[model samples]
Each structure stands twice: as C-alpha cells, then as structure tokens.
Target chain A: MITLTHVHKSFGDNHVLRGVSLHVPKGQSMVIIGGSGTGKSVTIKSVLGLVEPDSGRIEVDGREVHEGDRDAFLARFGMLFQGGALFDSLPVWQNVAFRLLRGALKRPKEEAREIAIDKLRRVGLRAAVADLFPSELSGGMQKRVGLARAIAADPEIIFFDEPTTGLDPIMAGVINELIREIVTEMGATTMTITHDMTSVRTIADRVAMLHDGVIQWEGPISEMDGADDPYLAQFIRGRADGPIEAVR
Target chain B: MSGLLSPVAALGRSMLALLAYVGRVAIFAGATVAHVFRPPWYWREFGWALMQIGWLSLPVVGMTALFTGGALALQIYDGGARFQAEFAVPSIVAIGMVRELGPVLGGLMVAARVASSIAAEIGTMKVTEQIDALVTLSTHPMKYLTVPRVVAATLAVPVLVAVGDSIGILGGYLVGVTRLDFNAAAYLKNTFDFLELWDVTSGLIKGAVFGFIVALCGCYFGMNSGRGAQGVGRATKSAVVTASVLIFAANYILTEVFFAA
Candidate 1:
C-alpha cells in the first residue's frame, strides 16, 4: 500500500502539487486521471523520490519512502515510463532483466535471460524479439517491452505513467487489456496516471481525478460517471468550458 | 546614473552565475570521485566506457598528432635553417610533440569526439526518463553512468596520449629522414636523445587531468541538461566547448607547473 500526505512541489513560480493526499490500498488498481501539467507525473515521481517534494510525507507499508536503504526501497516497485524509457544501448532482454543483471536483485546471466524471455512472452512478445534493440521495435512492441520490464521483477507495486499515450487506438486497447489482465493476475498494487478515459474504464478498479494540484474527486469507477462534482463531469465528458479551465 | 549602474549590476550577476556554475561542476566531480571508491562498481559499464572513450578515439587522435608532428618538423627545419641550426629539427620536433602537442591535441580530439557523444547520449537518456527508470530499478544513475565514464577516461586517455606521442615522433622521423634529407639513423638518435623521461611523464600526467576534465564536462552538462531535443543539443554543444576551454586552461597551468623556471 502507498500513501501521500499533503504533498506540495513547486518549480520556481509554477506550483505543481498543492497539498495532494491520496492512498492506494494493497493490491488495488488506483488510476489517477488528469489534464496535462496537472502534476500527475510529479506526484508519482515525488513518491519515488525522483523529484523531491517541497513539503510532504510519502510512505509505503507505513514506512517513510525515503527512509532506510534506497536500493531496498526501490526494489519493492517497478515503473513503466511514458516513453518506455528503455536503454537504447542495451538489447530488449537486457532492458527487461536490467535489475536482475545488477545490484541487490542480481541473478545469474542465464537465469536472468530466461526470466526476461518469459516476461516478454507474458506480454505477448516473441522470444526472438529479446535480442533486438528498443529502436528496432515498433511503438506497440516497445510499450509491450516496457510492460514486460515493469513486471519482469514481479515487484509488489507497479506504476504505469501514461501507459498508452502514444499508441494507436487498437494498440492502446491491447496495452490496456494487457495491463488489466496482468494487474489482476499478479495481484500487485498499481498506480496508473493517464488522461485516456478508455484506459481508465478498462483498467481502473478505483478512480481519482486530479486537477489544480489536488484530488478533485475520487471513488469507485462506477461512481465516477455520475459524480456530482462539475470538474469531474467536465473532465469525463471532455468539455472545454467548465470549472476546470481548458488552458492553464 | 541608472544606465551606468546597470552595466555594473549585469557584470556582478554574470560573475555570480559563473561562480554558481563552477560550484555545481565541482560538486558533480566530487560526487563522481566519491562513487568511484564505493562498492557495487559497474565494471561492465566502465569497460564499455573505456572502449568508447579510449579505443574508439585512436584514429582521430593519431591523425591529429601525426599531421601536427610533421608540420612542426617542417617549421623547425625552415626556421632553424635561417639560424644555421637545421640540426635542431629532429630534437625540437620530438620534444615539442612529447611534451606539449601530444596530450593537449589528443585530449582536444577526444573532447570533440567523446565529449559530444557522451553529452548527447546521456542528455537524450535524461530527456527520455531513462535516468529516473534507473533510480526506480534500484540503481544509482551516478554509479551506473558518470563514475564509469570518468574513471575510464581518467585511466585510458594517458595511454592514448602515449600512443599518439609515438606516432607523432614517427611522423617527424619520416619527414626528417625523407623530405628534409637527414640520415634516418641520425634523426632517430637525435629524437631519442632530446626527449627526457620527465618530459614524456609530464605530458602523460596532463593527459590524465585533461581526460578527467573532458569526461566530467560531458557528464556534468549531460546530467544537468534541460528537457527535449533542443536541450540535448545545447548540452552537447556546451560539453564540447567547456571540455575544450578547460583542456587549454589546464594545459597552460600544468605547463607552468612542470616547465617554468
């Protein structure tokens, strides 16, 4: 389980996250929907300590996120970045098995490779795709590779940052389905950030709409549609004029 | 009065900004050095860096040294001719190449090639969020990226300078014996005789220092790069420019320390 309390982050004049507090219970899929530059990425990054928050408390399993050993802390979680963020220098399998090839989670080369191929298969990728570089793969294939890597280590918590942003509708649907199926099968706690309403419908068990650096509304997916909040309604309906302005 | 004061204020601001930039680079270099001695050393990354920063730079460094040495030989022979000291050509060429030209030119060449490549590569990685991915994967980006490169360049560029020195002397020898019509054996003897152990060693030491500067500039500019393709382009340009300028400045200070009376 993960919890963020009163998280506030600002970049010079831009106040991104202002008193953002949220929780994702153990093994639940918490999808955060927000417009561009609403600090959705920064919120997750703050929890991961990639971006230091100006004022906040982030905890996993009731322990401070920044406390104790960093390597151990990070080992509990995996991330699938918006761009896939696969290392171009490495082959696909190496990227998938990166954590396994080095540091605390290190395994033998053959064993790591085997696991990478297995994860690739789980993501519907062929074993032969393992040796090719990330650039060699198609956009959908790259996203699949990123997904494979995120789940490769079988982490307790997984963060998907805009998982289907750049893919075509069909490919996006495939990724959304894969994410939904995988999250259910693994029973891992997940926090996904995206503006894709379709993805939210498909993957979210619980939904939270983030706006103006705060959680405007949050509840079960079923409640999201009929929520009385105008901001939530405008966002869900893709309206340009509403309580939430179209442009910032 | 306000107009006159504005220039002074601008100068003060520029000075402060320059100081801040230097302080940041110093901190980055210090952290990189600290990571070098820590455990979980990424030998694979270090080895790869060594190959890229060292082995791959040979062709450009060699060509630069060879041409410069040949040109130095010709100039020395022509100038010495007026002073009735044409015999100084071989010794001067050898001493100049080994002492100053070898490491400085080699370092500059590596800076242009390796520094630009490193800055672009790391800057792109930063933009793509691969750096954050490294962090989430339980790896320190500094350990995984900067330490290997800085250490590899520090250890490898001296060897490159040494190789460049020899090739450069060979270039001079070819010119002296054939073009300048000097006896081949005599030219070789004079080159060997004029070169001191300290001269070659001093250049190698400069090579190590220059190597450190080049890689540090690349990594520093890269890790601190702003976002997007334009940001990466700026980082690459800054890396090469900073590495080159620092190499020249370091070379001068080192020369003063080693050879000044």
Candidate 2:
C-alpha cells in the first residue's frame, strides 16, 4: 500500500500542494482527477520522491520514505510519464528493456531483448515494432511502448501520469484497456493522474478529485456520479458555468 | 519613484530565479557524482559515452593538433630567423605544442562538437520526458544519463590529449625536415630531447579537467532546458559557449599552477 500524510509543497509564494493526503491499497488502482496545474502531478512526484515535500511523510508498504533514501525507495516502483518519454537514441526493445540491460538488475543482452519483446506482446504491439526508434512510431504506439516499459520490471507500485492525454479516442480506449489488463494481471498498486473521464471509468477502482492543492472529493468510482459535492459535479459533467473558475 | 522601484524589484526577481536554477543544477550534479561511485554503475550507458566522448573525438583532435603544430613551426621559424636562432625551430615547436597548444585546442574543438551534441541530445530527451521515463522505470536518471558521460569524459580526455600531442609533434617534424631544410634525424632528436614528462602530463591534466567541464555544462544546460525547440537550441548554444570559455579559463589556471616561475 502507498500512503501520504499531510504533505505540503510550495514554490515561492505559490503552494502547489497544501496539507494534502491520500492512500492506495495493494492490488487497487486509484485514479486522481483534476484540472491542469492543480497539483495532481506534484502529488504523484512527491510520492515517488521526485518532488520533496516540505512537511509530511510518504510511506510505501509501511516503510517511511526518507528524503535521503529516494533511490532505494523508488526501486520498487515503475512510472509512466504523461509524454511517453521514450529515448530517441534507443530502439523500442532497448527502451522497453532499459532497466534490464544495465545496472544492478542487468541481464545478458539477448535475455533483456527477449523480455522486451514479451512485454511488447503483452501491450498488444507487434514484435516487428521492437527494432524501430521512437521517432518512427505514431503517438498511440509510443504510449503502448511506454506502458510496456512501465510493466517490464513487474514493479510492485506503478504510477501513470496522463496515460491518455494525446491519443485519439479509439487509441485512448486501447491504451486504457492495456493499462487495466496489465495492472490487474500484476496485481500492482497503481496511482494514475489524468483528466480523461473515460480513463477514470475504465481504469480506476477509486477516484480522488484534487482542487486548490487539496483533495476536494474521494470515493469509489461507482459513487463518483452520484456524489453531491459541487466540485465533483462540475468536474465530472464538464460544465463551463460552475464554481470552479475557467481562469485563475 | 514607483517606476524605478518596480524595475528594481523585477531585476531582483529575475536574479533570484537564476540563482535558484543554479542551485537546482548543482544539487542535480552532486547527486549524479555521488551515484557514480555507488554499486550500480550503468555499464551500457558508460560504453556509449566512451564512444561519444572519446572514440568519435579522435578525428577532430588529430586534425586540430596537426594543423596547429605545422602553423606553429612556420611562425616560430619566421620569428627565430630575425634572431638568427632558426635552428631552435623543432625544439620550440615540440615544447609549445605539448605544453599548451595541443590540449587546449583539442578541448575547444571537442567543446564545439561533443558538448553541443550532448546538450542537444539530453535537452531533446528532457523536453520529450525521456529522463522522466527513466525515473519511472526505477532507474535513476543521474546514474543512467550523467554518470556515464562524466566518467567517460574524465577517463577519455587524457587519451585524446596524448594522441593529439604525438600527432602534433609529428606535424612539426614534417614541417621542420621538409620546408625548413633541417635534417630528419636532427629534428627528431631535438623534439625528443626538448619534450619533458611535465609538459605532456600537464597537458593531459588540462585535457581531463576541460573534458569534465564540457560534459558537465552540456548535461546541466540540457536537463535544465525548458520544453520546446527554442529551449533545446538555447541549451546547445549555452553549453558550447560555456564549455569553451571554461576550457580556456581552466587551461590558464592550470598552466599557472604547473609552470609558474
């Protein structure tokens, strides 16, 4: 399980995260939804120790993650960045098997490549795509490759940042299905941040809405539509005329 | 009064932003350096950096040293003729090339080529989120990205400098024997006798330090770059300029330390 307690982060006068907290139980997919610049990314980064919180504690599997031990703490988790940050210099298989090809967890080159091809197959990609660079692939294919890399290590914790931000609706649906299938198969604890309602519906077991640097609403996905919170209602229905301002 | 005060405040704000960015870059660099000595060194990345920082740099380093050595011999022979010391050509050329010209020029050449390439490559990766992806994959970006390049530069620059020194001396030998009417054996003996261990060692040390600065500036600016084409371009330009200037500055300081009479 992943737990955050009373976390606060600020840059200059702007407090991006303010005394906020949330939790994701083991084998559950928790999706956080919020408007752009609403601290959703900051919250996830803080958990991963990418962003240090000024005051508060983050714990993964009951061990508190200290600021100094970020690498050790992060070893158990896998992340999917919003932009599908594939290495342009590397071919798809190398990008997928990047972790396995070197460092402490490294295997022989052929073994790592095989694992990469297997992960690619799991993400519904053809083996032929394995040798191509990221520049050659379309947007949706890149996302699939990113997903393949994320699950390649069989990490206990997975974080997805805007998994469907740039894809066509059909492609988005495909990615959503792949994420759902893989996360469920691995039984990995997952935290996903996105604005897409379809992704939230398809992937989230529990949903949290972030606004003004705090959790405005939190509940199971089934309860999201029926919830009476105005912020939740405004966000879910995508209405223009609501208490949530269109501009700051 | 209000206009002057507001402008002052804006200037202070910009200065503070710049300082903060520098601090962040320092912290990132420190983290990378620390991880370099740790257990999990990225060998694949290290191998790639060795190729990028060392092997590919050979042609530029060789060409620069060869031309500079030839030109120095010509200029020295011209100056020596005025003093009736034309026979001092080969000795002076070898000493000058080994001590200062070869390593400094080689470093600047590499700064122009490798530093900009690293910056543009890493900057493009940054804006595209490849570094972020590395982070999410349970791979420290520092270990995977910066450490390899830093190690490669530190280890490879000395090798490059040594090769350049040899090639440079050879260029001078060629010029001295062919154009200056000096005997081949005499030129070779002069070069061999005049060159000292300190001259070559000092040049190699300068090369290593310059290489570190080049890679550091490249990785620093690249990772700190903003997201877009404009940001990558700025990073590349700043990395090359900063590396070249730093290389020259370092050369002078090192020269002072090594040879001050």
Candidate 3:
C-alpha cells in the first residue's frame, strides 16, 4: 500500500503540486491521470525519493519512504522512465542487468545476463537483441527494453511514467497488454502516470484524476464513466476547454 | 548615483555567485575523495577512465610540449644573440621547458580535451534521467560516476607531465644542437647541469594539482548542469573555462610557494 498526504512541491515561482493527497490499497494498480507538467512525474518521483517534496509525507506499507536504509528502500521498487533512460554506454543486456552487475544486489555476470535475456524475452524481445545498444533498437523495442529493465530485479512495486507516450497505436496496445499481464500474474502493486485514456482503460484497477495538484475524481474504472464531476467529464471527453488549462 | 549603485549591486551578485560555485565545487571534490576511500569500488569504470583521461590524451599534450620547447629554444637563442650571449640558449631552454611551459601547457590541453568531454557526457546523462535511474537502481551517482574520473585524472596527469617534460627537454636539445649551431656534447652538458631535481618535481606536482582541478570542475559542472541541449553545451563550455583558469591560477600560486625568493 502507498499513500501521499498533502504533498506540496514547487519549482521557482511555479507551484506544480499544491497539496496532492491520494491512497491505493495493497496489490492494486492505481493510475494517476493529469495534463502535462501537472506534477505527475514529480508525484511518483517523490515516492521514489528522486524529487524531494517541498512539504508533505509519502508512506509505503505504513513506513516513511525516506527514512532508514535508502538503498534497501529503492531496491524494493522498479521504475520505467518516460524516455526509457537506458544507459547509452552499455549493451541492452548489460543495461537490463545493471542493478545485478554491481552494488548490493550484484550477481555473477553470467547469471545476470541469463536473467536479463529472460526478462527481455518476457517483454517480447528476442535473445539476440541483447548484444545491441539502445540506439540500435526501434522506439517500441526500446520501451520493451525499458520495461524489461524495470522488472529485472522482480521488485515489489513498479512505477510506469508515460508508458504509451511515443508509441504507435498497435505498440501502445501491446505495452498496455503487457502491463496488464505482468500486474495480474505477479500480483505486484503498481502506480502508472499517463495521459493516455486507452492505457487507463486497459491497465487501471482504480483511476484517480489529478487537477491543479489535487485529486478531483477517483473511483474504480467502472465508476469513472458515470461520474458527473465536470472536471472529470471535461477531461474524459478530451475537451480543450476545462478547469485544467489546455496551454499548460 | 543610481547607475553607480546598480553596477555595485551587479558586482556584489557576481561575487556571491562565484563564492557559491566555489563552495559547491569544494563539497563535490570532498565527496568524490571520500568515495575513493570507501568500499564497493568500481575497478572497471576506473580502468576505462584511466585510458580515456590519461592514455588517450598523450599525443596532444606531447605535441604541445615538444613544439613549445623548440620555439622557446629559438627565441632564447635569438634574444641572447642581441647581447652576444648565445651560449645561454641550451640552459635557459631546458629550464623553461622543465619548470614552467611543460605542466602549464599540458594542463590546458588536457582541460580542453578531457574536461569538456566529461561534462558533456555526464550532462547528457542527467537530461535523459539516467542519473535518476542510477539513484533508483540503488547506486550513488557520485560514487559510480565521479570517483573514477577524479582518481584517473589525478593519477594520469602527473605521468603525462613527466613524459611531457622529458620530451620538451629533448625538443630543446634537438634544436640547440642542430639549428643553433651549438656543439651537441656542450648543449647536452649545459642542459644537464642547469636543470635541477626540484624544477622537474615542481612541474609534476603542478600537473597532479591541475589534473585534480580539471576533474573537479568537469564533474561539478556536469552534475549541476541544467536540462536539455543548451544546458549540456553550457556545462561543457563552463567546465573547460573554469578548469583552464584554475590551472593557471594554481600554477602561479605553486610557483610562488615553490620558487619565489
């Protein structure tokens, strides 16, 4: 279970997250949907402790996220960045197995490579693609590699940032399906940040719509459709005119 | 009155910013040094950095030292001829190359090549979120990235300085015997007699210090670089400029401490 209580963050004069508070029960897929630059990434990063919140508390499993044994805390979570964030200097297999190559979770090189190849296969990548660099892969393949890397260590919690942003319709559908299967099969707790409405339909167990740094509407996906809140209606209908500024 | 006060305010701000930069760089350098002595060390990254920073930079530093030595010998011989003192060419050339020109020029060249590159590579990584990825992967970016580079530069530059000094002395020797019409045996004897152990040691020490400055500036600007292409470019340029200036400043300070009467 994860919860963010009155989390406030600001960069210079721009207040991105004013007072965001949300909760997701254990082993549930909670997807946060908001317009671009609305602190969606910052919200997830706060939980991961990548971006420090200006004020508020984020707790995972009733323990403060930033307290006691940082490495061990990070080890329990996996994140798939919007840009894939694969290391250019390393081959795909090495990038996927990066956590296993060094530091506390280090494994034997051969075993790490084997596990990397297996994860790659799970993400629909062939074994031979392991030797190539990230630049050599297509956008879809890179996202798959990023997904493979996020799940490489079999972390308890996985966060996905814009999993479908740059992908084609078919590729996006495939990624959504992969996310669904992984969540159901592993029974892992997940928090996905995305603007793609279709990904929300496929992957979310419960959906929370964030606006102006606060949760405006939250319910099971079945209830999201019937919700009468004007903000959620405006967003779900893809209207340019809404409480959320379109220009932002 | 307003115009005069505005400039004063601007000057104050600039001074404050410079002090802030100095403080940040000092702290970064301290963290990098602390990481070097701690465990979970990365040998492979350190080895690669040694090759990239030290071994790959040999040709440029060597060429700069060599040509400067030759030019110094020519200038000394010509200038000494005005007073009918051409015999001073070999000794003065050797001393100039070993004492001042060798480490300073070599440091500048490495700063241009190595510091700019380190900044660009690391700044790009920051933009693409690879640095955050490193953090989420449970690895400290300072340890994983900065330590190896600083250590490599610190160790490699002294060796580079030593080699550059030898080649520069050789350059002066070649020009002295052939172009200046000085006897080869006499030129060799004069060079050996005039150059002291302290002169070469001071240059090598300066080289090590310059290397530290280059690595520190590169890593500091890189880790603190803003986002996007412009940010990366700005960081690269800043790293080279700061490294070169610091090297020159350090050179002057070291000379005063080591040789001033």
Candidate 4:
C-alpha cells in the first residue's frame, strides 16, 4: 500500500538516505531494522512527508503523498513516535481522541471521549487512566496511551517509530505483543522501525535490514535468520567485529 | 595578505547571515499572518493563548508601570523644584507614563515573561515530535500553534497598555498627593488636561506592534529550534533577547514617527 522509489535525502554533509527503495503491501507488517543514524526514521518520515525527500517519489494507495489535500492524505494514517509525543497539556483521552476531535474526522465531544476510552481499553489501559496527563503516567503506560492513539481513528496505515525504545524488557514484550495483536485485528498495513530483535520477532511478518543508507536484505521473518547476507548476519548476531563497523 | 583579508571576509559573512536571518523571520511572520486569515480557525487554542498572553500577564505589567510612574513623579517633582516648576509634576508624569513608559515597559515585561515561555513550550514540543504528531493528525502546527498566539498578543497587548497607562497615572497621583503634598483634585485635573487622545492612541499602536514582535520572535525561534533540552534553552534565551531588543528599537522608531518635528 506504500511505496518509496530511489528516495534520497541529505542534511549538509550527511547523506542519510542515499537511494532507498522499498514497498509494503496492504495488511502486512514491515519492520525495518537498522543501526542508529542509518536513515530508518527518515525513510518513514519521507513517506509521511514529515521530512521531504531531496528527490524521488513516495506513494500511498497509488497516489503521490504530496499531491492531494494534506489533511485528507494524513487522515488515512497514524503514527506512534519514539517519545510518545503526547500533548503535554492534554489529558490522555484528549490525546487519544485528538484527530477525532478536529478536522475532517471530527466527531462530537462525547463520542470522541467514548471512543478514546474504548481505544484505551483496547491497549490494556483502564478507563480511569484517561483523565491523567502524559507526564503523570509511567513510561510503559505512556507507550500504551500512544499506541491507543495510533489506533484510535482506525487508520488504514500506522507507523510505529521505535515502539520499544526506553522500555523495560517486560514492558517492551508487552508492547510488542500488543502491537502484533492489534495490527492483526485491525488488518492495518504497518511500518515499524526498530533495532529491537525481540520486537522484530514478535511484530514483523516481513523484515528489511537497512544499512549504509540502503536496504541490505529483505524477506519473510522466517528467512531472516538464515539469510546469507554478511551485513544482515553481523546485525542479527549483534557481533562487534564483522562487516558492520563497531565504530563510526 | 590573507590575514589582512580575513577580518573583512568574516564581517561580510556575518552580514550575509544577518540578512538571511531577517529574511527567514519576515517570511515566517508573513506566513503566520496568512494563516490567521485562512479558515479552520482553532478557537480553543486561540482562547488559551489569549489567557496566557493577555490575562495572565496583567500582574507583572501592572507592577512595572506602577513603580515606574511613582519614580517618575518623584524625579519630576525634585527636578522641577530647582527651577520653581514643582507644580508641573502632574502633567509631566501623566504625559511620560502615557506616551513613553506605558507601552515600552509593558511590552518589555511581556517579552520577558511570555516570549521565553512560548519559545520553551514550542521548542520542547518540536524536540519531542509533538509537532510532527500534529502534522500526522491532520493539523497544521502553524495554524494550531502560531496563529492563535500571534493573533492573541496582537489583539491583547494594546489592552494591556491601556490598563497599564491608567494604573501608572494612578500611581503618580498617589505619590503627588500623599508624599509630594499636592492637592489631589488639582493633580488629577492637570493629568487629565495635559493628556490628549493622540498620546494614548499612539502608545496603543506601539503596544500592538511590540506585541507582534514579541510573539513572532517566540514562535520563530521556537519552530526553528534545534533538538534536545539544550536547544530549547537556547531558543528561550534567543526569543527573550530578540523580543526585548525589537521592543526597544520599535519603540524608538515609533516615537520618531509619532512625535518628531
């Protein structure tokens, strides 16, 4: 449902995405694995048009991302940022129902609140938690709230940016499991970027290893373990000494 | 020879950077004004901004005006005593507070309080990706954030200046009666007689311009802030500094335009 063709981006001397090309079919979970600063975030952001690519094309559902009404285009997708990125001034329910309370997807205030609570419950958060601010919640609960928000509008596509970063192992596992279950239930096309191997195993139907500003390897999750690519081998094994450099 | 040219090159580079910075800020201001006229106005956000930039700012602005007015009364009384012109205290205090001190000091105080806060809040939001989150949620960050604030300050600061001017004149009145031993009714009469409509209106116009500069500096530095806590700190500092300097500079130009012969 989403496609990026030979996309290139740079920030002065840093050529973050040299020429990245990838595609995710409808209703599939595509987890992009890459080390820090390999342009994984930039890749997803390019598709979302959050960060405009210097060159090349990005399309979602067969239309250019930057061509049509921005509000309408963005309405079809949701995102969970690494920092949760919930509005600090808003309560959890308001954050979850943000899109539903504004713009084209707007609903009545009462209906929006009810849907926010329902989505909160779907992510294992109690309805009581809906009144609390983001800063009042723990990191794990904040992540769940963010997840609830990502799925709140029942968007066709969802992007999870490092969904497991800064969480304890148990919390990370729970988030990964919740993501897998929710993505499956919603039948939503998803693009998740993370270096968390456990999250990759639990959440990805397909995996793409990104390195050196390009996709080094991609296939089904089952084939990722035995892929003969040296860079993929170095990454999945977590070896310090290999084709992937340990030092910058 | 290269050493001799190095300083000249550095000056040229600094000039270019300053020009570029001014250009970017002008464009940002233009875009914010454009968004203000467009549809999809977020009244909730606008209401909150009005509360922050207007209502909440009253205490500091009031206190500053009061103290400055009292001090100006004392100085005028003392200085006028030397030339047998002590009775001129009331008129001078009223004119000074209404024309020069009211909007300028009020704008500076708001710049310190509001500009820094706006910058820090928006800068941190940018760092944490709330801005990008807003975008993905089909909200324009400019419309949702900047327009409300700029519009609020533009509309609200003039009101603040008017309030501050009255309170400041009251302060002078109190000092002239209680401490300077002037007749209360005569003091108020002189204050009213000397203050014209243009004196107060000119200050209000300056207030609006200063308010625009304060919020614009805050939003501009904030939206363009770099990453992390340190970046937010830098943005806050830059916002206050820019707003304060702009207030003074704008105050001078405005005074020249209003009162110059």
Write one digit per residue (lDDT tens) for candidate 2, span A103-214: 5577999999999999999998999999999999999999899888888878888899999998999999999998998888899999999999999999999999999998
Task: Give the lowest summed-lDDT range of ten residues in model 2 chain A.
Answer: A66-75
lDDT per residue for candidate 3 within B92-154, as digits (tens), equals 887887788888999999999999999999999999999999999998999888998999999
Complex DockQ, candidate 4:
0.96
Write model 1 residue lDDT over A139-242, tens digit each, in one string.
99999999999999999999999999999999999999999999999999999999999999999999998899999998999899989999999998999998
lDDT of 4: 0.94
Ranking by DockQ: 4, 1, 3, 2
Instruction: Tell me the RMSD of model 4 versus the true structure.
Output: 0.9
Summed over model 4, clashes come to 0
- Tell me which residue pairs clash in candidate 4: none
- Model 3 residue B95 distance off true place after TM-score fit, in angstroms: 2.1
Error of 4 at B66 (Å): 0.8
Q: Which residue runs of candidate 4 sit more than 4 Å off their true CA positions?
A: none
Roughly what TM-score does model 4 have, to 2 decimal places? 0.99
Q: List TM-score (chain A only) for every prediction.
A: 0.98, 0.97, 0.98, 0.99
Task: Kindly report which residue stretches of model 2 are placed more than 4 angstroms away from their true locations once superposed.
Answer: A67-72, A103-109, B1-34
lDDT of 1 by residue, B8-32 (tens): 9999999999999999999999999
Candidate 2 residue pairs in backbone clash: none
User: Residue B30's C-alpha lDDT in candidate 4?
Assistant: 96
